[model samples]
Structure formats: C-alpha cells, structure tokens
Target: MTETTIPKRGVPLWVQIIIWVFIAALLVLVGITLNKRQQGTVQPGDKIPDFTLPLFSGYEYEGKSEVKLSDFQGKVVVLNFWASWCKPCEQEAAELEEAWQFYKPGGQVIFLGADYVDTEPEARAYLKKFGITFANGPDMGTKISQMFRIRGVPETYFIDQTGELYYVKVGPFVSVNEIKSIVDQKLK
Candidate 1:
C-alpha cells in the first residue's frame, strides 16, 4: 500500500488573495459613500460648510482676493446663488441689491452673491445692471452650489450669526421686503 499525502484543507492562496482584494475594495466604496452622504446637503438648523470664494473682478471684500465663510463669524450671511442667464434671478436682482444696501450700514449682516454657471463678462454686466455693491464672487467649478445641494439657480441661503442655516429660498425674492424679511429674521 502506498502512503498518500493529505490534501490541504484551507482555501488556495490565489483565491484568498482575490477575496481580500475584493473586500478591501468594498470597504473603500462604503467609506466613500458615507463621506459623501455626510457632506451631501445642508438644511435649516445645520451648520453651513465653509468655503473660500474668489471674488470676481471689482467684487472683492475689503480689497481681499477671496472671502471665506469663516471670516464672518458673528454676522448673519445672505448667500445667493444666481446665474447671468437666469430670468428669475433678474427679477430679484435689484431687490437683492436694495436689501443689501439696507443692511450694509448696520455692519451686522453681510450679503454674498455666488455667480453660478456664467461667464465672467456676463456676470459682471449683470452685477452692473443691478448695481450690486455687496461682495460678489464666482462659485468656481460650482463648489458652493454642491455644498448647499442647490437644485437650480436663484436659490438663496440665509445663515444665522451662529453659522447655522436659518432659511432657504428656492425661488427669487419678489421685493426688497421679501428679501429683508428673511435676513431680518436671521439678524434676530
């Protein structure tokens, strides 16, 4: 009778390596998904994400090249997302400027315009047309919109003094009072 060697009882080396690789990939995918979910969208009462926005030509704040959300720690922020081609944005353009002017003297509130999906020349012209004097900047690759998960143009986010989101307006404001109503409430 010949003595036969016993066969290995465990998984083959190649099979085990493949399984570990697949498991690692799965873990990485799950991690990425969770991270995206955490930063996906902001809502009322949630802290808004901080971002540095490069001001467009002639829109700098305090002569600075860019502005960061964290820079205004104790001030209410009126952040508006608009596009040069948006008709609804045009409707509220002057109203927003009026509201900005109304709050500018107080120094407790700041208005920030984030131009979305527009050429610099057109954005500048739109600002000039509306006579916008507050700090305005380009979104630059739509990063700001992505942070807020904006559905469309003309969306505005009212951030309270504590840096939490106070309100969200999906459409353009109809009047200066309409814009002021929200900012005024946030000021409180």
Candidate 2:
C-alpha cells in the first residue's frame, strides 16, 4: 500500500520564511535600481521626447525664469543635461558656455542647461564654479530626466526648432570648435 502526504495549507513554515526573505531581498534590489535610474543613463539616437519640467531662476542674467522645451522653439537649441557632481560635465561647461556665446550673436543656436537631480543652490553654485553663464534650471523632481530618459550627466541634445533631436553627445565637449562643428552640422 502506498500513501501520499498532502502539502501544508498555509505553505510550509520553512518554505514561507524562505519566500518572504527572498521577496524582501528582491524588493530592496529593485528599490536601489530605481533610485539609480532616476538619474538616468542615456544612449545615442534616443528620440527627445517633449517635456516641460521646471527650470529654476537666477542662473541667467536676464529673462531669468523657468524654461520648457516648447519655450525655445523656432530656434536651434542645444539642450545639455548635467549635474553639479559630474566631473566631465564641469569640464565641458565652459565649452558649452563658449558655444552659447558664439551662437547667441547670430541667434543661430540657443544653449540651455538643466541641473539634473540637484538642488537650486548646488546648481547655481556649480554655474558659478564652472563659469557657465547660459540659463539653467533645476530638475527638482527629476521630471526632465525621466521624460528624456537621461542616462547620466553630460548628455547634450542638438534639437532643431521643431523640437526634434538631431544629435546626442553623451560626454563633454572639449572645445568651442568641437561644439561649433556639431552645432553647425545640425543647426542648419
């Protein structure tokens, strides 16, 4: 004669404990990954989706106010995403500033910066430290980062007046010449 043992109704105590432990571990890992992704890690050829996140004031000399992607339409825009803590971003800030200076005269291309995942005070401080005179904004809640799916700091999007992304630079620009070359290629 053969007999079958039935499984426990509320799950085996040992098995339940193991499952709970695993679930807890998994939740913890997921939470960490999500926090990391909030800062984003972008890639090339990613389409620039339209987003209207808040741009904090005081970074620019005049018209120092909030700006959205839609705000600067009808002009070639260099939308650079960066943070205060990124070394490469700090390195490229001046080059981007120079590009802004060069392009501002012709009104050919407008350059704007976004202080991703940072405080207004920190962002403004970075601007002062890096000598980035272009207008900037704070991604207070990281709305813009999520919207564009930014992979990391120092991602520059060459967007035409229609808000279409033409080129994406993942790292810093070395010189105004380099910035100009890319801008010239796309602004037209």
Which candidate should be chosen as best, given lDDT against the real structure?
1
Model 1 residue 94 distance off true place after TM-score fit, in angstroms: 0.7
Lowest lDDT 10-residue stretch of candidate 2:
39-48
- Measured by TM-score, the strongest candidate is 1
lDDT of 2 by residue, 79-105 (tens): 799988888997888888877888887
Residue pairs in collision within model 2: 40-151, 41-151, 42-151
lDDT of each: 0.89, 0.77
Candidate 1 lowest-lDDT run of ten: 34-43
What lDDT is obtained when candidate 1 is compared to the true structure? 0.89
Return the TM-score for each candidate structure.
0.83, 0.71
lDDT for each residue of candidate 1 in 62-82, tens digit (9 for 90 to 100): 899799999999999999999
